[model samples]
Target: MEGHIVLKNVQKSFGPKQVLRGLSVSVKKGRSLVVIGGSGTGKSVMLKCILGIIRPDAGEIRVGGESCIGLKGKDRDAFLARFGMLFQGAALFDSLTVWENVAFGLIQGRGMARHAARDIAVEKLSQVGLSSDVAALYPAELSGGMQKRVGLARAIAADPEIIFFDEPTTGLDPIMADVINNLIVDCVKRLGATTISITHDMASARKIADDIAMIHKGQIIWQGEANKVNVSGNAYVDQFIHGRADGPIQMDVLKA
Candidate 1:
Protein backbone atom coordinates (compact mmCIF):
# COMPACT_ATOMS: atom_id res chain seq x y z
CA MET A 1 0.00 0.00 0.00
CA GLU A 2 1.14 3.52 -0.78
CA GLY A 3 1.69 6.22 1.80
CA HIS A 4 -1.36 8.36 2.45
CA ILE A 5 0.87 11.37 3.07
CA VAL A 6 4.46 11.57 1.80
CA LEU A 7 7.29 14.04 1.98
CA LYS A 8 10.31 13.52 -0.23
CA ASN A 9 13.58 15.42 -0.29
CA VAL A 10 11.79 18.24 1.47
CA GLN A 11 14.07 21.21 2.13
CA LYS A 12 13.19 24.50 3.71
CA SER A 13 15.37 27.38 4.87
CA PHE A 14 14.65 30.62 6.64
CA GLY A 15 17.35 33.16 5.80
CA PRO A 16 20.69 31.47 6.66
CA LYS A 17 19.28 28.84 9.00
CA GLN A 18 18.12 25.70 7.22
CA VAL A 19 15.22 24.04 9.04
CA LEU A 20 14.20 21.01 6.97
CA ARG A 21 16.97 19.57 4.85
CA GLY A 22 15.98 16.68 2.67
CA LEU A 23 13.45 15.63 5.30
CA SER A 24 11.32 12.71 4.18
CA VAL A 25 8.74 10.50 5.88
CA SER A 26 5.40 8.89 5.15
CA VAL A 27 2.22 7.88 6.93
CA LYS A 28 -0.18 5.19 5.76
CA LYS A 29 -3.93 5.57 5.57
CA GLY A 30 -5.84 5.43 8.89
CA ARG A 31 -2.56 5.33 10.79
CA SER A 32 -1.14 7.84 13.23
CA LEU A 33 2.46 9.02 12.94
CA VAL A 34 4.02 11.06 15.69
CA VAL A 35 7.12 13.15 15.08
CA ILE A 36 9.32 13.49 18.15
CA GLY A 37 11.96 16.17 18.43
CA GLY A 38 13.23 18.92 20.66
CA SER A 39 12.89 22.67 20.13
CA GLY A 40 13.82 24.04 16.66
CA THR A 41 14.13 20.55 15.22
CA GLY A 42 11.84 21.42 12.28
CA LYS A 43 8.89 19.46 13.65
CA SER A 44 6.39 22.30 13.39
CA VAL A 45 7.94 23.53 10.15
CA MET A 46 7.32 20.14 8.56
CA LEU A 47 3.64 20.38 9.41
CA LYS A 48 3.44 23.93 8.04
CA CYS A 49 5.09 22.76 4.83
CA ILE A 50 2.39 20.13 4.44
CA LEU A 51 -0.34 22.64 5.26
CA GLY A 52 1.08 25.16 2.76
CA ILE A 53 1.41 27.70 5.55
CA ILE A 54 5.15 27.90 4.90
CA ARG A 55 6.42 27.02 1.47
CA PRO A 56 9.43 24.74 1.53
CA ASP A 57 12.44 26.22 -0.26
CA ALA A 58 12.72 22.85 -2.02
CA GLY A 59 11.12 19.40 -1.92
CA GLU A 60 7.80 17.65 -2.50
CA ILE A 61 4.77 17.24 -0.27
CA ARG A 62 1.92 15.01 -1.32
CA VAL A 63 -1.33 13.92 0.26
CA GLY A 64 -3.14 10.85 -1.10
CA GLY A 65 -0.85 10.96 -4.18
CA GLU A 66 -1.43 14.57 -5.29
CA SER A 67 1.26 17.21 -4.88
CA CYS A 68 0.09 19.97 -2.51
CA ILE A 69 2.75 22.57 -3.14
CA GLY A 70 1.77 25.78 -4.93
CA LEU A 71 -1.96 25.14 -4.52
CA LYS A 72 -3.93 28.39 -4.74
CA GLY A 73 -7.48 29.76 -4.57
CA LYS A 74 -10.13 27.05 -4.52
CA ASP A 75 -7.56 24.30 -4.87
CA ARG A 76 -5.83 25.42 -1.69
CA ASP A 77 -9.12 25.82 0.12
CA ALA A 78 -10.27 22.39 -1.03
CA PHE A 79 -6.99 20.84 0.04
CA LEU A 80 -7.16 22.40 3.51
CA ALA A 81 -10.74 21.26 4.03
CA ARG A 82 -9.52 17.67 4.15
CA PHE A 83 -7.41 18.29 7.27
CA GLY A 84 -7.81 19.47 10.87
CA MET A 85 -5.28 21.04 13.26
CA LEU A 86 -4.95 21.44 17.01
CA PHE A 87 -2.25 23.97 17.63
CA GLN A 88 -0.03 24.40 20.67
CA GLY A 89 -1.66 26.33 23.54
CA ALA A 90 -5.06 25.59 21.97
CA ALA A 91 -4.81 28.96 20.10
CA LEU A 92 -8.45 29.83 20.75
CA PHE A 93 -9.97 33.17 19.92
CA ASP A 94 -10.79 35.06 23.06
CA SER A 95 -13.60 36.99 21.39
CA LEU A 96 -15.52 34.04 19.94
CA THR A 97 -17.77 31.86 22.02
CA VAL A 98 -16.74 28.21 22.34
CA TRP A 99 -19.41 27.01 19.91
CA GLU A 100 -18.63 29.81 17.47
CA ASN A 101 -14.95 28.88 17.56
CA VAL A 102 -15.77 25.24 16.91
CA ALA A 103 -18.15 26.08 14.06
CA PHE A 104 -15.92 28.70 12.48
CA GLY A 105 -14.59 26.38 9.82
CA LEU A 106 -17.99 24.93 8.94
CA ILE A 107 -19.74 28.26 8.69
CA GLN A 108 -16.86 30.23 7.20
CA GLY A 109 -15.00 27.67 5.15
CA ARG A 110 -17.93 25.54 3.92
CA GLY A 111 -20.61 28.24 4.11
CA MET A 112 -22.88 25.98 6.13
CA ALA A 113 -25.95 27.53 7.78
CA ARG A 114 -25.48 28.80 11.34
CA HIS A 115 -27.99 26.38 12.88
CA ALA A 116 -26.45 23.37 11.16
CA ALA A 117 -22.95 24.35 12.15
CA ARG A 118 -23.97 24.95 15.75
CA ASP A 119 -25.56 21.50 15.94
CA ILE A 120 -22.41 19.84 14.64
CA ALA A 121 -20.34 21.96 17.01
CA VAL A 122 -22.40 20.80 19.98
CA GLU A 123 -22.07 17.18 18.96
CA LYS A 124 -18.31 17.54 18.49
CA LEU A 125 -17.95 19.18 21.90
CA SER A 126 -19.73 16.20 23.44
CA GLN A 127 -17.37 13.81 21.67
CA VAL A 128 -14.47 15.64 23.37
CA GLY A 129 -16.19 15.10 26.77
CA LEU A 130 -17.58 18.60 26.99
CA SER A 131 -21.19 19.56 27.69
CA SER A 132 -23.59 21.73 25.74
CA ASP A 133 -23.53 24.40 28.44
CA VAL A 134 -19.83 24.99 27.90
CA ALA A 135 -20.43 25.78 24.24
CA ALA A 136 -21.76 29.26 25.03
CA LEU A 137 -18.76 30.25 27.16
CA TYR A 138 -15.69 32.08 25.93
CA PRO A 139 -12.17 30.68 26.05
CA ALA A 140 -11.34 32.74 29.12
CA GLU A 141 -14.33 31.39 30.95
CA LEU A 142 -12.99 27.80 30.86
CA SER A 143 -10.09 26.08 32.55
CA GLY A 144 -6.98 25.17 30.59
CA GLY A 145 -8.14 21.59 30.19
CA MET A 146 -11.58 22.66 29.07
CA GLN A 147 -10.04 25.01 26.52
CA LYS A 148 -7.93 22.17 25.17
CA ARG A 149 -11.07 20.04 24.88
CA VAL A 150 -12.71 22.89 23.02
CA GLY A 151 -9.77 23.05 20.63
CA LEU A 152 -10.11 19.32 20.10
CA ALA A 153 -13.83 19.61 19.36
CA ARG A 154 -13.07 22.20 16.71
CA ALA A 155 -10.41 20.03 15.12
CA ILE A 156 -12.78 17.10 14.46
CA ALA A 157 -15.82 19.22 13.82
CA ALA A 158 -15.34 18.89 10.06
CA ASP A 159 -14.55 15.18 10.21
CA PRO A 160 -11.35 15.77 8.32
CA GLU A 161 -9.55 12.95 6.53
CA ILE A 162 -6.22 13.93 8.14
CA ILE A 163 -5.32 15.66 11.37
CA PHE A 164 -2.20 17.53 12.49
CA PHE A 165 -1.72 17.88 16.22
CA ASP A 166 0.95 20.38 17.31
CA GLU A 167 2.01 19.71 20.87
CA PRO A 168 -1.48 18.65 21.93
CA THR A 169 -0.53 18.11 25.55
CA THR A 170 1.86 20.99 26.08
CA GLY A 171 0.45 22.82 29.10
CA LEU A 172 -1.93 20.27 30.57
CA ASP A 173 -1.36 18.35 33.77
CA PRO A 174 -0.38 14.71 33.33
CA ILE A 175 -3.90 13.43 33.97
CA MET A 176 -5.48 15.93 31.58
CA ALA A 177 -2.78 15.29 29.03
CA ASP A 178 -3.60 11.62 29.17
CA VAL A 179 -7.25 12.47 28.82
CA ILE A 180 -6.50 14.53 25.69
CA ASN A 181 -4.38 11.73 24.32
CA ASN A 182 -7.24 9.28 24.86
CA LEU A 183 -9.64 11.65 23.15
CA ILE A 184 -7.22 11.99 20.24
CA VAL A 185 -6.92 8.21 19.88
CA ASP A 186 -10.67 7.80 20.10
CA CYS A 187 -11.41 10.63 17.68
CA VAL A 188 -8.93 9.39 15.08
CA LYS A 189 -10.37 5.89 15.34
CA ARG A 190 -13.91 7.19 15.00
CA LEU A 191 -13.04 9.27 11.94
CA GLY A 192 -10.68 6.67 10.46
CA ALA A 193 -8.34 9.55 9.79
CA THR A 194 -4.64 9.54 9.08
CA THR A 195 -2.74 11.78 11.50
CA ILE A 196 0.68 13.40 11.96
CA SER A 197 1.45 14.82 15.37
CA ILE A 198 4.54 16.74 16.52
CA THR A 199 5.28 16.63 20.20
CA HIS A 200 8.12 16.55 22.72
CA ASP A 201 5.97 14.56 25.15
CA MET A 202 6.95 10.93 24.90
CA ALA A 203 3.85 9.76 26.71
CA SER A 204 1.59 11.52 24.23
CA ALA A 205 3.55 10.21 21.27
CA ARG A 206 3.52 6.67 22.53
CA LYS A 207 -0.20 6.77 23.12
CA ILE A 208 -1.26 8.31 19.80
CA ALA A 209 1.27 6.95 17.35
CA ASP A 210 1.36 3.67 15.51
CA ASP A 211 4.66 4.72 13.99
CA ILE A 212 7.11 7.14 15.52
CA ALA A 213 9.71 9.20 13.67
CA MET A 214 12.51 11.14 15.28
CA ILE A 215 13.70 14.21 13.41
CA HIS A 216 17.02 15.97 13.89
CA LYS A 217 18.86 18.69 12.02
CA GLY A 218 16.10 18.90 9.40
CA GLN A 219 15.95 15.18 8.61
CA ILE A 220 14.33 12.00 9.84
CA ILE A 221 17.05 10.22 11.79
CA TRP A 222 14.94 7.24 12.80
CA GLN A 223 11.52 5.79 12.16
CA GLY A 224 9.83 2.72 13.60
CA GLU A 225 6.90 1.31 15.53
CA ALA A 226 6.13 3.18 18.74
CA ASN A 227 6.88 0.13 20.87
CA LYS A 228 10.48 0.05 19.62
CA VAL A 229 11.22 3.67 20.47
CA ASN A 230 13.01 2.85 23.70
CA VAL A 231 15.29 0.39 21.91
CA SER A 232 15.86 2.31 18.69
CA GLY A 233 19.70 2.15 19.10
CA ASN A 234 20.29 5.55 17.55
CA ALA A 235 22.26 7.73 19.96
CA TYR A 236 20.16 10.80 19.23
CA VAL A 237 17.00 8.85 19.84
CA ASP A 238 18.51 7.49 23.05
CA GLN A 239 19.40 10.94 24.34
CA PHE A 240 16.01 12.35 23.40
CA ILE A 241 13.87 9.59 24.85
CA HIS A 242 15.95 9.34 28.01
CA GLY A 243 16.21 13.13 28.36
CA ARG A 244 19.96 12.86 28.68
CA ALA A 245 22.20 15.91 28.52
CA ASP A 246 25.15 14.01 27.07
CA GLY A 247 24.99 12.21 23.75
CA PRO A 248 25.25 12.84 20.01
CA ILE A 249 22.52 15.46 20.41
CA GLN A 250 23.57 18.94 21.55
CA MET A 251 21.60 22.01 22.57
CA ASP A 252 22.64 25.55 21.66
CA VAL A 253 22.84 27.43 24.93
CA LEU A 254 24.40 30.83 24.84
CA LYS A 255 26.49 32.19 27.68
CA ALA A 256 25.33 35.36 29.31
Candidate 2:
Protein backbone atom coordinates (compact mmCIF):
# COMPACT_ATOMS: atom_id res chain seq x y z
CA MET A 1 0.00 0.00 0.00
CA GLU A 2 2.90 2.31 0.69
CA GLY A 3 4.06 2.15 -2.91
CA HIS A 4 0.91 3.53 -4.48
CA ILE A 5 1.57 6.54 -6.76
CA VAL A 6 -0.93 9.30 -7.40
CA LEU A 7 -0.48 12.24 -9.75
CA LYS A 8 -3.40 14.64 -9.86
CA ASN A 9 -3.84 17.49 -12.33
CA VAL A 10 -0.13 17.62 -13.09
CA GLN A 11 0.98 20.22 -15.60
CA LYS A 12 4.43 20.99 -17.01
CA SER A 13 5.81 23.44 -19.53
CA PHE A 14 8.99 24.71 -21.12
CA GLY A 15 8.62 28.42 -22.00
CA PRO A 16 5.79 28.62 -24.57
CA LYS A 17 5.53 24.85 -25.02
CA GLN A 18 3.21 23.23 -22.54
CA VAL A 19 3.86 19.49 -22.21
CA LEU A 20 1.73 17.91 -19.50
CA ARG A 21 -1.72 19.45 -19.52
CA GLY A 22 -3.51 18.44 -16.35
CA LEU A 23 -2.24 14.86 -16.58
CA SER A 24 -3.58 12.64 -13.85
CA VAL A 25 -3.07 8.91 -13.19
CA SER A 26 -2.52 6.47 -10.39
CA VAL A 27 -1.15 2.96 -9.82
CA LYS A 28 -1.91 0.84 -6.79
CA LYS A 29 0.84 -0.76 -4.75
CA GLY A 30 2.30 -3.95 -6.21
CA ARG A 31 0.68 -3.37 -9.61
CA SER A 32 2.27 -2.73 -12.99
CA LEU A 33 1.19 0.18 -15.19
CA VAL A 34 2.46 0.53 -18.73
CA VAL A 35 2.11 3.85 -20.57
CA ILE A 36 2.15 3.72 -24.36
CA GLY A 37 2.32 6.67 -26.76
CA GLY A 38 4.17 8.05 -29.72
CA SER A 39 7.21 10.22 -29.11
CA GLY A 40 6.85 13.62 -27.38
CA THR A 41 3.66 12.54 -25.59
CA GLY A 42 5.07 13.56 -22.19
CA LYS A 43 5.52 9.94 -21.08
CA SER A 44 9.19 10.37 -20.17
CA VAL A 45 8.47 13.86 -18.83
CA MET A 46 5.91 12.42 -16.48
CA LEU A 47 8.44 9.93 -15.13
CA LYS A 48 11.00 12.69 -14.66
CA CYS A 49 8.44 14.76 -12.82
CA ILE A 50 7.62 11.88 -10.50
CA LEU A 51 11.32 11.25 -9.87
CA GLY A 52 11.93 14.95 -9.13
CA ILE A 53 14.34 15.04 -12.06
CA ILE A 54 12.02 17.73 -13.37
CA ARG A 55 9.63 19.63 -11.16
CA PRO A 56 6.11 20.09 -12.46
CA ASP A 57 4.87 23.58 -13.26
CA ALA A 58 1.78 22.74 -11.19
CA GLY A 59 0.06 19.75 -9.51
CA GLU A 60 0.44 17.07 -6.89
CA ILE A 61 2.60 13.94 -6.87
CA ARG A 62 2.03 11.67 -3.94
CA VAL A 63 3.78 8.37 -3.36
CA GLY A 64 2.32 6.19 -0.64
CA GLY A 65 0.28 9.14 0.68
CA GLU A 66 3.30 11.43 1.02
CA SER A 67 3.86 14.51 -1.14
CA CYS A 68 6.88 14.12 -3.46
CA ILE A 69 7.15 17.54 -5.04
CA GLY A 70 10.03 19.84 -4.14
CA LEU A 71 11.83 17.18 -2.14
CA LYS A 72 15.27 18.38 -1.03
CA GLY A 73 18.62 16.91 0.05
CA LYS A 74 18.27 13.75 2.10
CA ASP A 75 14.53 13.63 1.50
CA ARG A 76 15.10 13.47 -2.24
CA ASP A 77 17.81 10.87 -1.82
CA ALA A 78 15.60 8.80 0.41
CA PHE A 79 12.74 9.04 -2.04
CA LEU A 80 14.95 7.96 -4.91
CA ALA A 81 16.31 5.03 -2.91
CA ARG A 82 12.83 3.51 -2.95
CA PHE A 83 12.76 3.43 -6.74
CA GLY A 84 14.86 1.79 -9.48
CA MET A 85 15.02 2.81 -13.12
CA LEU A 86 16.01 0.87 -16.21
CA PHE A 87 16.63 3.73 -18.58
CA GLN A 88 16.14 3.75 -22.32
CA GLY A 89 19.08 2.15 -24.18
CA ALA A 90 20.23 0.56 -20.92
CA ALA A 91 22.23 3.77 -20.15
CA LEU A 92 25.08 1.82 -18.63
CA PHE A 93 28.24 3.60 -17.60
CA ASP A 94 30.92 2.58 -20.08
CA SER A 95 33.61 3.24 -17.52
CA LEU A 96 32.30 0.74 -15.01
CA THR A 97 32.29 -3.03 -15.20
CA VAL A 98 28.93 -4.81 -15.16
CA TRP A 99 29.18 -5.84 -11.54
CA GLU A 100 30.45 -2.42 -10.50
CA ASN A 101 27.60 -0.75 -12.30
CA VAL A 102 25.09 -2.99 -10.57
CA ALA A 103 26.68 -2.36 -7.19
CA PHE A 104 27.10 1.39 -7.69
CA GLY A 105 23.91 2.32 -5.91
CA LEU A 106 24.54 -0.05 -3.03
CA ILE A 107 28.09 1.17 -2.59
CA GLN A 108 27.51 4.86 -3.26
CA GLY A 109 23.95 5.42 -2.13
CA ARG A 110 23.69 3.11 0.88
CA GLY A 111 27.44 3.04 1.67
CA MET A 112 27.61 -0.75 1.66
CA ALA A 113 31.06 -2.32 1.47
CA ARG A 114 32.24 -3.29 -2.02
CA HIS A 115 32.53 -6.99 -1.25
CA ALA A 116 29.01 -7.26 0.13
CA ALA A 117 27.57 -5.06 -2.63
CA ARG A 118 29.30 -7.16 -5.29
CA ASP A 119 27.82 -10.33 -3.84
CA ILE A 120 24.33 -8.85 -4.17
CA ALA A 121 25.19 -7.50 -7.60
CA VAL A 122 26.27 -10.93 -8.85
CA GLU A 123 23.12 -12.45 -7.44
CA LYS A 124 20.96 -9.81 -9.13
CA LEU A 125 22.81 -10.36 -12.38
CA SER A 126 22.16 -14.09 -12.03
CA GLN A 127 18.48 -13.37 -11.55
CA VAL A 128 18.53 -11.56 -14.87
CA GLY A 129 20.24 -14.58 -16.49
CA LEU A 130 23.74 -13.09 -16.61
CA SER A 131 26.51 -15.36 -15.39
CA SER A 132 29.12 -14.27 -12.82
CA ASP A 133 31.78 -14.33 -15.55
CA VAL A 134 29.88 -11.74 -17.51
CA ALA A 135 29.84 -9.48 -14.49
CA ALA A 136 33.53 -8.68 -14.92
CA LEU A 137 33.05 -7.41 -18.45
CA TYR A 138 32.15 -3.88 -19.55
CA PRO A 139 28.88 -2.80 -21.15
CA ALA A 140 30.63 -2.31 -24.51
CA GLU A 141 31.68 -5.94 -24.47
CA LEU A 142 28.14 -7.23 -23.98
CA SER A 143 25.50 -7.66 -26.64
CA GLY A 144 22.53 -5.26 -26.73
CA GLY A 145 20.34 -7.83 -24.96
CA MET A 146 23.03 -8.50 -22.41
CA GLN A 147 23.44 -4.79 -21.69
CA LYS A 148 19.71 -4.49 -21.08
CA ARG A 149 19.91 -7.42 -18.70
CA VAL A 150 22.74 -5.73 -16.82
CA GLY A 151 20.74 -2.55 -16.57
CA LEU A 152 17.89 -4.60 -15.12
CA ALA A 153 20.30 -6.18 -12.67
CA ARG A 154 21.39 -2.71 -11.51
CA ALA A 155 17.79 -1.61 -11.12
CA ILE A 156 16.89 -4.51 -8.84
CA ALA A 157 20.18 -4.77 -6.99
CA ALA A 158 18.81 -2.47 -4.32
CA ASP A 159 15.49 -4.34 -4.14
CA PRO A 160 13.57 -1.11 -4.70
CA GLU A 161 9.92 -0.84 -3.71
CA ILE A 162 9.09 0.70 -7.08
CA ILE A 163 10.67 0.47 -10.53
CA PHE A 164 10.42 2.80 -13.50
CA PHE A 165 11.23 1.15 -16.80
CA ASP A 166 11.89 3.53 -19.67
CA GLU A 167 11.52 1.58 -22.87
CA PRO A 168 12.92 -1.59 -21.37
CA THR A 169 12.70 -3.60 -24.56
CA THR A 170 14.17 -1.06 -26.94
CA GLY A 171 16.99 -2.12 -29.30
CA LEU A 172 16.48 -5.86 -28.86
CA ASP A 173 15.33 -8.54 -31.29
CA PRO A 174 11.73 -9.68 -30.80
CA ILE A 175 12.81 -12.95 -29.22
CA MET A 176 15.17 -11.22 -26.81
CA ALA A 177 12.57 -8.58 -26.06
CA ASP A 178 10.19 -11.31 -24.97
CA VAL A 179 12.90 -12.78 -22.80
CA ILE A 180 13.36 -9.41 -21.08
CA ASN A 181 9.62 -9.10 -20.67
CA ASN A 182 9.44 -12.49 -19.00
CA LEU A 183 12.31 -11.53 -16.70
CA ILE A 184 10.57 -8.27 -15.82
CA VAL A 185 7.39 -10.12 -14.90
CA ASP A 186 9.37 -12.59 -12.85
CA CYS A 187 11.35 -9.88 -11.05
CA VAL A 188 8.34 -7.68 -10.32
CA LYS A 189 6.34 -10.62 -9.05
CA ARG A 190 9.20 -11.62 -6.79
CA LEU A 191 9.58 -8.12 -5.32
CA GLY A 192 5.89 -7.24 -5.47
CA ALA A 193 7.07 -3.80 -6.55
CA THR A 194 4.86 -1.07 -7.95
CA THR A 195 6.00 -0.47 -11.54
CA ILE A 196 5.52 2.22 -14.17
CA SER A 197 6.94 1.36 -17.57
CA ILE A 198 6.85 3.54 -20.68
CA THR A 199 7.20 1.68 -23.93
CA HIS A 200 6.01 1.76 -27.53
CA ASP A 201 6.32 -2.03 -27.77
CA MET A 202 2.85 -3.50 -27.45
CA ALA A 203 4.22 -7.01 -27.00
CA SER A 204 6.20 -5.89 -23.97
CA ALA A 205 3.26 -3.90 -22.63
CA ARG A 206 0.78 -6.74 -22.99
CA LYS A 207 3.19 -9.14 -21.37
CA ILE A 208 4.14 -7.16 -18.26
CA ALA A 209 1.30 -4.76 -17.64
CA ASP A 210 -1.68 -5.35 -15.40
CA ASP A 211 -3.11 -2.06 -16.68
CA ILE A 212 -2.33 0.20 -19.61
CA ALA A 213 -2.58 3.96 -20.05
CA MET A 214 -2.22 5.92 -23.26
CA ILE A 215 -0.92 9.47 -23.14
CA HIS A 216 -1.35 11.90 -26.00
CA LYS A 217 -0.31 15.56 -25.97
CA GLY A 218 0.62 15.39 -22.28
CA GLN A 219 -2.58 13.84 -20.92
CA ILE A 220 -3.91 10.37 -20.39
CA ILE A 221 -6.29 9.75 -23.27
CA TRP A 222 -7.19 6.29 -22.03
CA GLN A 223 -6.45 3.92 -19.16
CA GLY A 224 -7.78 0.43 -18.46
CA GLU A 225 -7.17 -3.28 -17.92
CA ALA A 226 -4.52 -4.70 -20.27
CA ASN A 227 -6.77 -7.61 -21.22
CA LYS A 228 -9.46 -5.16 -22.35
CA VAL A 229 -7.23 -2.87 -24.41
CA ASN A 230 -8.28 -4.39 -27.72
CA VAL A 231 -11.86 -3.44 -26.87
CA SER A 232 -11.10 -0.06 -25.31
CA GLY A 233 -13.44 1.48 -27.94
CA ASN A 234 -11.82 4.91 -27.81
CA ALA A 235 -10.76 6.09 -31.25
CA TYR A 236 -7.20 6.94 -30.24
CA VAL A 237 -6.78 3.59 -28.52
CA ASP A 238 -8.18 1.86 -31.57
CA GLN A 239 -5.80 3.67 -33.92
CA PHE A 240 -2.80 2.98 -31.71
CA ILE A 241 -3.26 -0.73 -30.97
CA HIS A 242 -4.20 -1.53 -34.55
CA GLY A 243 -1.28 0.57 -35.87
CA ARG A 244 -3.68 2.15 -38.29
CA ALA A 245 -2.62 5.17 -40.30
CA ASP A 246 -6.25 6.17 -40.93
CA GLY A 247 -8.10 6.95 -37.74
CA PRO A 248 -9.02 9.76 -35.37
CA ILE A 249 -5.34 9.97 -34.43
CA GLN A 250 -3.40 11.66 -37.21
CA MET A 251 0.34 11.58 -37.69
CA ASP A 252 2.19 14.61 -38.99
CA VAL A 253 4.28 13.02 -41.67
CA LEU A 254 6.55 15.15 -43.82
CA LYS A 255 5.39 15.61 -47.40
CA ALA A 256 7.52 13.53 -49.79
- Which 10 successive residues of model 1 have the least lDDT summed? 246-255
Tens digit of per-residue lDDT, candidate 2, span 25-108: 999999999999988889999999999999999999999899999999999999999999999989999999999999999999
- Write down the TM-score for model 1: 0.98
Off by over 4 Å in 1: 254-256
Candidate 1 per-residue lDDT over residues 65-154, each given as its tens digit = 999999999999999999999999889989999999999999999999999999999999999999999989999999998998999999
lDDT of 2: 0.95
Q: After superposition, how far is residue 89 of candidate 2 from its true place, in Å?
A: 1.0
lDDT of each: 0.96, 0.95
With candidate 1 superimposed using the best TM-score fit, by how many Å does residue 213's alpha carbon deviate from the native? 0.2
Model 2, which residues run further than 4 Å from truth?
1-3
